[model samples]
Target: MAEDDDIAERRLAFGRAFIGALPHARALGMTLVDLTEGRAVMEMPYDARLIGDPETGVIHGGAVSALMDTCGGAAVMAHAQTPAGTATLDLRIDYMRSATPGRAIRAEAVCYHMTRSVAFVRATATDGEEGRPVASATGAFTVERGR
Candidate 1:
């Protein structure tokens, strides 16, 4: 294989490794869908215990934001082609509709840009119904320098 191809293979491997390193993420009940050069996909299944309002069975907005933030960070790390800590500079999320309990919510995140010190990303979460997004987010991230 060519040198670039070799590096690409290695980066993908590193993405998986970095993901596995976050055990708390596992306890959060999120599943890794995929990671690419400037993107990451994930899924979170609805659980009543994690729901903000048990009566409504709707997942909390804060929980949705956390998922998006994580996705943005993962996207930055994958696209930077380096292992790094990403801090949320700004995050905006819009809740179009409420999430239903027991449904799996899928998130798709893309890093549109990553400069030397920052990364820009957007992600959306949905439970497959078409009219409205369960949640959507856009954020800027600061990539830490050095260890």
Candidate 2:
């Protein structure tokens, strides 16, 4: 039981440190909502400064990409037996629709697979809706062995 508690504490510490280390995450108002084995959830609040189309009040695609990427990295880190650190090797995002105006975007990422060298993650961004995603993404990340 003590060992399990230690592991849980370490995981929480890692999540906090990872989120704090990213400047873009801070600037974009990214918040770490949950972190557990193989999954992570994050949220980014809409801000006027992040608008891509002033006329439409849509947040920029770049912001969404950043959120997905960060969420993916967090998922990789959360996976049990994950490497010491990971870097995104490839990320592909599909924009299904623009985010709802005045709504915060939430991203959930799952590290579905991990091998010796890479981790595979799938993620989606939504504005507090069911079955409707503003964007979806798949990514591969390099797993650094041997801390």
Candidate 3:
């Protein structure tokens, strides 16, 4: 039991450090909300500076893309057999609607599959609502071995 607890603590610490080390994540105020094997959730508070259109105050699509990409990377790291590090190989995001001006956005990612060299992830960004996503994404990441 002690060993399990220690492992969990270490994993949480590592996840925190990983998110903290990214400049863009830090700039966007991204927080790791939850993490487990093969899954991760992250949140970014609404900020006026992130609004793409000053008139409408809609959060930029780029911000959503960045959130999903970071969340996907975190999901890959949460996978039980993840490699030393990972890099995005490809990412595609489809925006369904604009994020509400005053609402924080959250992204959830699942690493559904992994190979020796690649990991596949699906992710969604939403304004804390069910079924109404601001955007959805699918991504491939390169799994670096033997760091």
Candidate 4:
């Protein structure tokens, strides 16, 4: 790894140590790909049982939203610069296209602002295709200050 990347690995290691442990996260096959000051990427393998539209074989909108939401909050949490807890304030997901059932979905988040108590984020979910977004989101999350 490059020098900067090595430093980032240490920071992300810290983030992974904090507040990333949730049982449901593992159950849903969520994997944290990277954690930087203002960016994050996560992915999950496609599961047929997660599809709400079984007949259409598309990933569920709700599941898509959850994936987006988690990345958004995780972005803020990773960049929080203080000892604060974080929670989703609002998660708005727009489904641009259906996701392929057999393909894994990846969600990427970018944090534009991290205030004392709120963090602003934007994210996108994709299945490695051109002009096809499984979902996209923009939202803010509350950062609970202090231990």
Candidate 5:
């Protein structure tokens, strides 16, 4: 239906704007690959400037963390119950392994639960590899609605 398509477009635009508005996300070249209610996927391309170690050529952990965090916030913002704004309250990330050199990293986040004032999100980052994730994260975010 036209209404459904309109809503989807609006949400996608919101997700793009949200990522574009963040300086860190811009600097890291994160792309909004997909977005829907309660879910978002983002990608960060591999760049030598973002390498953590010259010897390993692995992407920095901080860049991965930022990608996950931004993806989580986008998921929360896209949730049906979330209206105006969201902010990261807490995020815990576990690095499973270094990202494969020269490979772009993709992160997907789901807003699994939401309360009146908070949202819970889980996310995973992979470096173009199937089954093996570079990192996984869980986060809580403040939610503001009806604004």
Candidate 6:
């Protein structure tokens, strides 16, 4: 039990550090909110600079995509069988609605499947609205096993 807890702690720490090291993640003000086995949650505070439309005050779809991609990678890294590093191979995001102004966006991702060389993830982004997501994504990531 103690060993498993220690492993989880170390993985979580690594996930945080990995996110902190990304230049884009930092620029977007992304924070790793949670990391557990095969799952991760990240948040990005609403920033005026990230607004796509000056009139609507809505955040850019690009920013939301970055958040989801980053969150997906974090989920892959949190998986028990994951390797030393991972990279995005492909990601498909579907936008459902614009994020509400002044509300931070949260993204949750789960690494649902893994092979020796790849991981599959699904993610959702929300902005304080229950059952309504700003965007949803499905992604495939490279799992670097031996490196």
Per-residue lDDT for 1-147 in model 6, tens only?
A: 999899878877888899999999999999999899999999999999999999999999999999999999999988889677899999999999889999999999999999998999999999989899989999999999774
Q: For residues 47-95, write the lDDT of model 1, one tens digit per residue.
A: 7767898788888888778778777788888875454678889999989
Better of 3 and 4 by TM-score: 3
The Cα error of candidate 5 at residue 8, in Å, is: 1.4
Clashing pairs in 6: none
TM-score of each: 0.83, 0.92, 0.94, 0.88, 0.94, 0.93
Task: Report the lDDT tens digits of candidate 2 across residue range 25-73.
Answer: 9999999888889899999998999999999999999999999999999
* Model 4: lDDT to the true structure: 0.81
Model 1: which ten-residue window has the lowest total lDDT? 78-87
Prediction-by-prediction clash tally: 0, 0, 0, 0, 0, 0
In model 4, the clashing pairs are none
**Per-residue lDDT of candidate 5, residues 1-147 (tens digit):** 999999899889878987898998999999999999999999999999999989999988999999999999999988888648888999999999999999999999999999999899999999989999999999999988764
The TM-score leader among the candidates is: 5
lDDT of 1 at 3: 90
- Minimum summed lDDT over a 10-residue window in model 3 is located at 4-13
Q: What is the C-alpha lDDT of each candidate?
A: 0.79, 0.93, 0.93, 0.81, 0.93, 0.93
TM-score of 5: 0.94
State in Å the error of residue 131, model 3: 2.1
Give the range where candidate 4 is weakest over 10 consecutive residues by summed lDDT.
15-24
